[model samples]
Target: MPKITSLAEPTQLHERILVIDILRGFALLGILLVNFTGAEIARTGRLDDEVRRLLDFLISSKFYTTFSFLFGLGFALQLLRARQRESRIVPVYLRRMVALYLIGLFHAILIWNGDVLLYYAAMGFLLILFRSLPQKLLLAFVILSLAFEFWTSLPSSPSMKISGLLPSRYTPEMEQQKELDRTLDYEKSREAWQNHTLSTRSGTYVEAVKARFQVWITGRDFLWSYFWATAFAMFLLGLYAGKKGIFHDLVRRQRLLRWTMWTTLPFAFSLNLISAYGPYVLGRFYQQIPDWGFSLLYVLAGPLGSLFYVSALLLLFVKSERWMRRLSFLRWVGRMPLSIYLMQSIIGTMVYYGYGLGMYSRLSYLVGLLLTLAVFALQIPLSRWWLSRFQFGPFEWLWRSLTYGKPQPVLVRRVRPAEPT
Candidate 1:
């Protein structure tokens, strides 16, 4: 929540915690991979089902969880810094959250329907409410939240089964009618989607926006408590990590990191493997809904995998200069996360939409993967260049400016040599 005034450049502030930036940068790349996968699944049948499965097993849910954790960590760190400066934290923080929500709304309605920013902004507000709770209480809340999520998502618990059986059995005619209705519904939904795709491909900006908003509205779940609870739980875990200084010094935490990596990763991999390939191996029932066991396994494994990834990456950053140098470009993208995130939506849509390149259904998974890497690789240099001349990423600057009710400086100052004395 600290304002980036002209007195101290925003670019310089990041120097103190380069690891967070690097982790953020790493998360961005993973995000692109999953986004591309989702885009492929939405518009076209999986180009390579194997690739999709591999991504599911390794990448799908991990990075977003990482981002959520980092968001919470950022909140805690910002609050501490605010206190140090004797600043009123809530006012600035509230403004920042509002700005984030606005930007997320713009992105979700106008650019991409897959936006997570709005959800993040909303959860961020809840995080503010609980930030002052004792650490033990926060951890307890986190566990309860995750448990709540798992409970809500249960395909059919005993209580649900009992309630479900209480409904009278449908008559033969009614059952037949229900089947017909479901068939008709599927056809209607499919037609709507086709039209939506057409609009996105060749429509004007207004048409595209309308199409996105319609799709999101049609698919929105007002009662999706499980997902919301899971997200908040991740945020709380992040708060706990920040409070514990787990990420403050990778070297000092090496043993903890190793223990996490060694202990959690194998089970994480095993659970995900089952989740990803269970249907093929076990039976079709494994693929059916209300398989609470598999769902719980998946939900539990995701955070563990995410933690393993973070610990491994931190160890690499602290131990190997070569790996650190290779991954340094991530810092550039990480620093301007808002800019880069929106940029991905804009560029990705332009590349795949009918109006731009119209490569949506045409692209194979391999091509999509290549495109993902290419776009991110291009962003690395561009972000570095932008940050070199500007104090903040464009959106970050705007958000900070709006939060403080004033314009923040963007361009770097050019120092002139002193005249000979």
Candidate 2:
């Protein structure tokens, strides 16, 4: 193996895919909508319920899966570049993950407990181990992982418990104790949520930080048991797509793209519909889906919906120049997603938290949705103007610099005429 000194450089503008950027920009919009209105807003009336239902069916879970897939695709691209340059990928990639993890820690601790970056950073290490796997094996792993996720999501499946891992000598007494412990855990979690809500809504910055930290700690079980697995599966899927060079020539792969888009749409729509309103709809027939069933549907819909979204966008880019131009505004936001994502959090906290506008738990779902759109609309032009003058977004520059152990050139230096010889 080569020395760690040989590392690949950052991707240049000419090498970027426009469709990927546009898709990322679109995902960011969905993420913003979900994040801003999520659990913070008050649900007061039918209007709020309807809006929440719509958002659940259309936006929730889909965008983050897309983002995770993109992260994997990006890793594949970096690996390819490293191989091309005959450079070692481990050193540079590890540094990148470390930097991302630190940033995520800052965001999660001081900013918001809902941060996903830390999870992504943790998964990045796992993804590195699979970088050298064959494409068939990679795809197989993704399918199996997703299948296992679905299996675990079924109501009939045995719920995971620490008692299950004990020796065969486990008796009825152990079962009773486990049940008692589960009840206690639930009550504790409920109390934690109350604290989180109160602090986030009206407490000082220090109080909010403590509350956020507590939330993060309590949420670890869900993060480890389900979220990370599905996210990693998406990462592998993206890596598979990248390794196959599918995005390199969308025109050549138009038929496949169309097939994927159309095939996934029915599943995405139907599953999401059931996940969102299965109780009401099925009750008419004197039947009802279990909570676990809804969870299963919601998890299954994420990747399917994300695939439909990406394929639809790629097809539009390939077939219609007009739509491409219309969506070109999103390109800027896509180009600097890190900055825009963090900015959304910062702005959202200020608008909702006690320290700023103090509107937490006050806005209705419709109002929150509208505010999300307005803020993202402003971000489009701001991102464009900022990127026009600089090589990268502020956070992106900082990330790159930290990864390389040196400051990267931020300004887009102009090429002046050659000096007279």
Candidate 3:
């Protein structure tokens, strides 16, 4: 751990944990690697087709799962935090989810329909039913649920091929496009999802159905489903770790850390890396894996890798002043994640959509990541500067205000401690 020589008396913000901000920082950076692509390609672009399957595979196949996995971790942290607060956990959690659901509803309609917050909020409701179950049973529920998803999600013909071969396409603009639309039907919707065109406007009814299902039914299943299969499991495991105070209890922490590293390093270096590389190597042979199989990998791989990353980051934060200072900006961006997520969605849409810069399918995945970094880099400084003078980013301010039904203090400043020594 970094020496606390500078603080001599650094204030404790929480009774026990500050890992939420740190973990969220890592997740925020990790998630944008994919969301930027979707926003850049689909929301912004008016392109007839998106042919970058390899890039999509990398982002969708790997990064988004990582994002979802970390989201579970964050959720687990929230629950753990509530336990510490001695507050009404259920009502607080429910209220928070309701707020998120409302935000997600507005977000999907005005912005991107592929929002995950709605699913998360919906899933929050389902997971409640199992909150009282024994840990072993809770885990079993996760496994069986995932198995069902995999079994239900059997492989089908490639969506692109199905769509490309179709004779019926309907766009108000082109006869050529109507021919394209005919081929996408009959095949499972999943294919179309993997290779769907950005500019392809479904009639209002189709968009509405997608919104309803994704926001309600499918979203709920996926949220709790992933929660149990990935985050909740890690959370239970983390809860165990926290309850034991692994770091404070060095021998136990060392043992846990050693095992965690030994188990996860190979996945980071091998499994995830391979999963990232598989589409390129396997080419057309890289049909998607079953959801259950993917879930198992997520539990085994993504969380493990995330653990390793978290451990490294934590130890670094504790021990290295320069490293912590350098990362302070990223940590700031993480703190205002709500604002950043929506901002990226909005700006990214404008850039690709007809409304703004209109950059769509034209950018490659690698370039999109670079572009994401550029945007994040801007936010790091901006957030730092903003937070230096304010308590919350603008959107965060509103979320806090709505959730608490009171305007949160916005600016941060050097001030006397609230409590007496």
Candidate 4:
């Protein structure tokens, strides 16, 4: 074990992983693109359809998987550090989660209903339960979690039939009632969507807040039902990688990464391709594919695609200095991911909300894409400049301060000259 340092100290600059930051920076771009296009006021027309399809194939689910894995890896690193320092991990980690939850709560309630930080914080607590499991047991847990997610994502017909075998008898009246319920649910969902769009685009700040709260409430079921398992699985995968030290020496792991990347590339591409365009293509030849089928495709594709992306990035960084320099800006953004992420939401809301330019649903996907790129391009230089003078981003400093129960120095203090000795 390494010698203990101050337990409260954050990871020092020299001890940081350059590749992780770069990968995070890259993931942020994808996340921004998805969020921007997804938030558009309108999503109709051939051009929009094409763009959406492209995004679905190329970006959807991939970046979040990466982020989730990174989160787990980060936790593993923290655990390792704690072990080295002979410190108990639970109290400090628990405080961090609580602080994160509070921050996410504020972001969701006041800024945007689509906030993911709150969900991440909730999952972090669950992660603590598996932290001490042996590597094999941890791997088993990840596999089982992903398997459960895939099973649940399978078409509902089989499960529905199995469920029908219970005490309740199927009847014509029951079928009629079920149909009615389905219709009512569809109408309710459509009405809610319309209300949300209108409120965000034109309503007052208070009205928007109310609408956001309602949307967040309504989304809780879906979030828990669909996302929780897959996200946790990715987190475990990251932990697995961290424990195995897969990322500690990219140079030594080059051959393994190359093999994994090449092996997974075909499946990732094929699965995502089918998920993106299969419905339209297969619909012509057979019955329409169920929504669950596409969802399953995504579940399978997400990790594979993310793995390929990470491996490719690592290889590129390790083998090519030119590429590394070009991508170095991502490190700045990665270093302060929390601040950048929240800033994205704030900027996005300001641009789309009623009190701002009110362009919520009015922009085309292409325009939104351009705007995402523009905003991120601007953020790169801004982050670089900020990091040059500060030890952490504003929000990062706050989170760290809260987690450690003390203020962390934000500015870079230059070396002081010795007085007359």
Q: For residues 8-122, could you state the per-residue lDDT of candidate 4 as single tens digits?
A: 7776676678888998899898888888888554776899889888998999889888899999999898888788778888988899999999899889879987788988999
lDDT of 1 at 149: 67
Query: After superposition, which runs of candidate 4 have C-alpha atoms over 4 Å from their true positions?
Result: 1-4, 155-194, 279-295, 416-421
Model 2, 267-367: lDDT tens digits are 99988887677777666542555566666675688899889999998999899999999998899999999999999999999999887789988999999
| TM per candidate | 0.84, 0.91, 0.66, 0.88
Deviation in Å, model 2, residue 391 alpha carbon: 1.1
Residue 384 in candidate 4, Cα distance off native in Å: 0.9
User: Cα deviation in Å at residue 61, candidate 2?
Assistant: 1.4
Give the worst 10-residue stretch by lDDT in candidate 2: 1-10
Q: Residue by residue across 185-274, what tens digits does model 1's lDDT show?
A: 456555656667788767767887877776666533321333677678879988888877877777898898889789988888877887
What does candidate 3 score on TM? 0.66
Model 3 residue 391 distance off true place after TM-score fit, in angstroms: 1.8
* lDDT value, residue 129 of candidate 1: 89
Worst 10 residues of 1 by lDDT: 156-165
* lDDT per model vs. reference: 0.78, 0.86, 0.55, 0.83
TM-score of 2: 0.91
Per-residue lDDT value at 103 in model 4 = 92
Model 4 — which ten-residue stretch has the worst lDDT? 156-165
**lDDT for model 4:** 0.83
Candidate 3 residue lDDT tens string, 1-421: 4332211111122332344455566567767766776644433232312323434323333334444544444445455555554444666556667887888877765676566677656665665565555656655765565444344343442223334447775566765554455443323344434332233232233454454444443233333334333444443444334434553444346555666666666665555544555556667755665555554554455555666666666666555668767666566777777888888777676655544555666675556767878987787788879877887778777766666666766766576879976
Error of 3 at 366 (Å): 4.0
**Which candidate wins on TM-score?**
2
